[model samples]
Target: MVDATIGQGGHSYLFGRALGPQGVVIGFDVDEKAMEKAEERLKTLKCRVILVHSNFSQIADELNNQGIKGADFILADLGVSSPQLGASEFGLSFLEDMPLDMRIDKRIQRSAADIIKYLDEKSLADLIYQYGEDRASRRIARFIVQSRKDFPITTTGRLANVVCRALGNRGKGRSRIHPATRTFQALRIAVNDELENLKALLDSAPEVLKRGGRIAVISFHSLEDRLVKYNFRKNKEENVYEIITKKPLIPTRQEISENRRCRSAKLRIARKISEGD
Candidate 1:
């Protein structure tokens, strides 16, 4: 089994409990802090645990390096973990006003602040539109460009303020969510190269999984969900996989009430198919 996004090893811990001494659970994560915490949490598990401080996109290569030919199960929960979001160093949330550095992996060369400081207005707008699915990307971009001319937008609070000013009063009272949510999400996705990494992981799963092995992905946003959905459908059509969830399984109301962050999660599962099947 593989926990592709083993944030703090919550899922891995539960799965590891069911595995015996011979079973192996390989967990992958880009965040060093997360890996550390996961290592601590999974220490007592009966199964052999191998934690990799790398992105799940490299699963195939990493597994090969470890002499693993194929895995029986892979689970990827794509949502940013709560601890990560709340960590000031990550700058993932606009709600608390942190430095505009959204690199989940410190190895990344550029931060969200660097992107805001350097990217041209048009490209910025396109990135927000493409990644965030926000309709007011142009206006937001214009505001960001214009504001940066006066002073650099160097913090999450300042960026959020700029976005709010761009939308004016509509951003404050009319929306159910904070106005800066989409903009922050756009920056985080860009900084992390999240979508591309997800694509890589999806492409490699079939090759890394044993015949009849299953892969499950939990995506938080529509962009991620769409990619998972289409990829599963394509693999199914090619007879490489059997889609386990015809429609994504969403969290129950009770579950959402317990953990609000999971409200938007969509889970999709697929099983690798043998030629004979």
Candidate 2:
């Protein structure tokens, strides 16, 4: 089994407990802190645990290097963990001010601040619209550009303020979420190259799984869910996969009540198929 986004080993620990001593669970995470925490959490499990401090996009290569031919199961939880969002170093939240560094992996050269500082107005607007699905991207970009001219937008609070000011009262009264939410999400995605990394992982899945092996992906937003949906559907058409969920399985009301952040989660599963099957 492989846990692709093994955030704090919550999923891995549960799965590891069910595995026999001979069973192996290889986990991948780009965040070194997550890997360290996961190692501590999974240490008591009976199964052999191998934690890799790297992106899931490199799963195939890592597995091969470990002399693993194929895996029986692969699981990816695409949502950012609550701890990650709250960690001041990640700079993922607008609720409190933090340095505007949204890179999940510190190895990445560019931060959210770099993107904001360097990207042109039109490009910034396009990035927000394409990645965030924000309709007010132009106004936000204009405001950001104008604000930066006065002083560099170096922190999360300042960026949020700029976005809120751009949309005025409409940002507060009409929306349940903060006005800066979409803009921040856009910047985070860009800083991490998230969509492309997801594409790489999806593309590598069929080759990495053993025959009849299954893969499950839990995505938190429409962009991530849509990618998973289309990839599974396309693989099914090619007889490379058998879609397990006819429609995405969403979180139950009970589950959402227990963990409000999971309300937007959508889980999809698929099994690999060969010519004989």
Report how far off residue 274 is in candidate 1 (Å): 2.4
Q: How far is candidate 2 from the true structure (C-alpha RMSD, Å)?
A: 1.4
Cα RMSD (Å) per model? 1.4, 1.4
Q: Could you give me the TM-score of model 1 versus the true structure?
A: 0.97
- Model 1, 1-277: lDDT tens per residue? 9999999999999999998888999999999999999999999999999999998899999999999988999999996899999999998888888998999999999999999999999999999999888899999999999999999999999999999999898787766889998998998899999999999999999999999899999999999999999999999999999999989999999999999999999999999996432
TM-score of 2: 0.97
TM-score of each: 0.97, 0.97
lDDT of 2 at 126: 99
* Cα lDDT tens digits for candidate 2, 167-203: 9988988679889989998998899999888999999
The pairs that clash in candidate 1 are: none
Q: Mark the 10 consecutive residues where model 1 has the least summed lDDT.
A: 268-277
